[model samples]
Target: MKMDCIRTTAAGLAVTLALCSPLVAQTATETDNDRLDNAWSDIIEGEGQLLSPTQYAALNNLAFQAAAARVCDGEKLDSEAFGKAVADILVDTETELTDNEHMQRNAAVLISFGTRYGLFVAEANGDNEKDFCAVATKLKAEPGKVPLFLK
Candidate 1:
């Protein structure tokens, strides 16, 4: 009788672990995504003060890939258009980013990220150009809906 009880407890524990493992992994992924999203928002909104170069690089890479995945199709990435779109979404006319060099740097970051992410997602999704373009267009039109799209 004691052996049977032990076996049942072990079985229950195994079942619990099996069921919870995937949820834990999913939760971790969601948390990471949220962190990345927040970082991107900060940078775009000009709150990325005193961030190390490595941190900026990571954030830039993540943002670029995510944005590219949302916005670019299989065609050549139009960096200028992407920069303008991002500027429209994140920058206000009243902001003090008047220097051409600063604006250009931001634009370059966007283009680099977009290009990398676009190529990656395109290849990963079997190069479905039509779908890629459609999704990219939708994302560009509604940048605020990125979290929903990511999910």
Candidate 2:
């Protein structure tokens, strides 16, 4: 009886550890993603020169996602889609900027492009209220005037 009880306890411990392994891995991945996001945000918000190659790649990924998300009207984009977008942008022939204007200027460009291309849909209603949803509605209303790439 004693041996049986010990074996049962050991089996329970093994199952519990096995179940927790995936959760541990997931938590680590989430932490890494969050750290990357925060670092990227800080870099963009800073008032300085252009980002390094790695930084640029990360921000480019974020920008592409922001653009593609608008293109699909809030449809959930997978990581692979965002990665492809970033890769395409990286290989484009356009010159990269390395000034404080990189963030703001790029943001404006995306907004303008999206609006001009009718890729953006504003969430703002006719109320003219200055809120997030209101702004989104207004932009979407004049999809041709708002850029899906902008903030």
RMSD of every prediction: 16.7, 20.7
Name the weakest run of 10 consecutive residues (lDDT summed) in model 1: 16-25
TM-score of each: 0.28, 0.24
| Best candidate, TM-score | 1
By lDDT, the best candidate is: 1
lDDT per residue (tens digit) for residues 55-112 in model 1:
3333333443354455454324455654554454334333466689567656755554
Tell how far residue 113 is off in model 1, in angstroms: 1.4
Candidate 1 clashing pairs? 71-136
- List runs of model 1 lying over 4 Å from the truth: 1-98, 127-149
- What TM-score quantifies how close candidate 1 is to the native fold? 0.28
